[model samples]
Target: MDESYFVGWGTLMLINAVLAQGKNRSGLNWFLLSLLLGPVATFFLALSEKK
Candidate 1:
């Protein structure tokens, strides 16, 4: 695998962490979603905050 791939994934994880914080979700949930759905999950989770 290329080094850039790891870097991009790491950056996305950080962004997901931030989004989770903003949504008031547990760190564990965010971490799990990061593993399961990557960056897209973060957006979906954020959008579902009020539901």
Candidate 2:
């Protein structure tokens, strides 16, 4: 319920989107998933192989 919380969440989402793109994944889809799954999504994205 604080500004820093939202800022951190948004930052994580952006990082996840970038990571997903690097793995040949959908940035928008991963961005939305990151909103829900946070670091779990990041872990999966990190483990995904490039196309």
Candidate 3:
């Protein structure tokens, strides 16, 4: 596997974490979820209402 793939995944995780925090959700939880769900996590985050 390419190193860039890992980097990209890590970057997405950070972005998801930030997006989760913006929605008043748990950033660390979202970050870990991103590691499993990847872009799906982003979709879920988008649909979540802000607190």
Candidate 2: the clashing residue pairs are none
Tens-place lDDT digits, model 3, residues 19-51: 999989999999999999999999999999999
Model 1 lDDT, residue 47, Cα: 80
Q: Assess each prediction's global lDDT (C-alpha) against the native.
A: 0.73, 0.92, 0.97
* Cα lDDT for residue 24, candidate 3: 92
Give the candidate order by descending lDDT.
3, 2, 1
Runs of candidate 1 exceeding 4 Å displacement: none
- For lDDT, candidate 1 versus 3, the one ahead is 3
- Taking the tens digit of each residue's C-alpha lDDT, what string does model 2 give over 1-51? 899999999999999998888888899999999999998988888887897
Q: What is the TM-score of each candidate against the true structure?
A: 0.70, 0.89, 0.95
Better of 2 and 3 by TM-score: 3
Best TM-score goes to which candidate? 3
Instruction: Judge candidate 2 at residue 6 and give its lDDT.
Output: 93
Q: Judged by lDDT against the true structure, how good is candidate 1?
A: 0.73
